[model samples]
Target: MQSTNLKFIFDHSAAAPGHQHDARVFSESLLCQRLEDGWRPLPQGVLLGDSGYAMRDFLQTPIPNPQTPAENRYNAAHKRTRSRIECAIGQLKNSWRCLSKLRVKDPAYAAEIIKAVIVLHNRRMDQNPEDLPAPEEEQEDQCPPEEMGTTEARAAGKQKQNELINFFVR
Candidate 1:
């Protein structure tokens, strides 16, 4: 996932059965789950997620069928922003050949390995940011099923998306 500073936050791993859609995993994540007061407020900024995740105040997604030029522009910008995270993912895979396929049978062990890779990726980038190779062109992955959020949250999200569209159009 991408952080507010447009950096990869963490990469989670799960077994085949537990490998649910991104939205499900995100919603159930410690950061996103219930907090001391309630759902964590996205004070930093909205996250750019693919269509698989539900639109919410903290998470913005493109309209399925953009009807206006403004909507189209918003989608374009949204995709560009989301691509950064995708590129990061690709870089991780490229840097660590072993990550392509974990031969380890234990899912827990595999997760540990992934965590280690994330740390190494960050460390390498920090030490020599220019050393990392550019992300290669890649085919878009199929959109995961949409995960609907609360009615109120959906409405709020739509409003936020519209605001962004207007900003982009201007």
Candidate 2:
């Protein structure tokens, strides 16, 4: 996970095989397990996730079919905010060329390498505070449909999403 300033917040260093879907990797993460056990990593904010993730009150995703303008606006804003992580990853890869094509044969070794890169990347950012990149232009995105089936968590997330849509409308 990354902050709004493109700084890494949480990185599940356990390397999953590249073939695994991101959602699956996320599901198997300690963060996800903690979230399931009612751990609120942040006190007063929610995290934005893509459609591949299961909806939760603290993990918001885009509306699959936004009929109202407010809902559409919400989706647009969600996409813009979520794209920060993508930019951060791009920045990380650009800075550490080794990350672009990690050829480590051992997953454990690869995970260690990734963790080291993240630490070094953060250090570089700290040293070169002025190296922050300009925000990328917002590009139109087709919000993917939510994939997780109905559940109690999804119900609560839907309610929270409605509240956000209303807030945006006003």
Candidate 3:
């Protein structure tokens, strides 16, 4: 599988099931690859994700200064810069009904569905930027979990892993 596509670009894909893992893994791998390629982490920190891409690992790296009252200010700034994919996802989900339904069965074919969704989303975005919602004043964990499928809050780690507990359990 091409890891390039693994990099989440949003679009109509925001609505698919079993997508939380793919989005997170893709974001993680993308960021790690950038780091390996010599991208430096800012001290006050860079908050590098949008909503769907959040996983515990994303938070493991200290965000500049975690204790500051300006909590995640820098990350939020960075987040908006990286939010085009997120806007595309939101718009795609809101605009396309097919995306809301995971009609494909085979895993490989499912990849095609995702690609199609993103491509459509990008095209739409190009045509009408007005439809997309702005990435919020500050990116916070919103949107309740998807029925049984849920997400864990990410805690930044200085080492390799950032472990987070699911809000679903308790």
Question: For this target, which candidate reaches the highest lDDT against the unseen true structure?
Answer: 2
lDDT of 1 by residue, 5-27 (tens): 43456634343334466667666
Candidate 3: which stretches are off by over 4 Å?
Answer: 1-24, 27-47, 50-65, 69-72, 75-85, 131-170
Of 1 and 3, which scores higher on TM-score?
Answer: 1
Local error of candidate 2 at residue 83 (angstroms): 1.5
Q: Could you tell which candidate, 1 or 2, scores higher by TM-score?
A: 2
List, in order, the clash count of every candidate structure.
0, 0, 10
Candidate 1 segments whose C-alpha is farther than 4 A from its true place = 4-7, 10-19, 34-44
lDDT of 2 by residue, 51-108 (tens): 7667778788888779999999999999888887777777787778898689878888
Provide the global lDDT of candidate 1 against the true structure: 0.71
* Clashing pairs for predicted structure model 3, backbone only: 11-88, 11-89, 43-64, 44-64, 45-64, 47-75, 59-156, 60-156, 60-157, 61-157
- When 1 and 2 are scored with lDDT, the better candidate is 2
Root-mean-square deviation of each candidate, in angstroms?
A: 3.0, 3.1, 10.4
Candidates in order have lDDT scores of: 0.71, 0.76, 0.43
List model 3 lDDT by residue over 1-170, tens digit each. 11122223432223333545544444445554564344655533333443344333323222433454343554454454455545544555666667668766675677687687666656765677576544333344444321221232332332223111121123
Top candidate on TM-score is 2
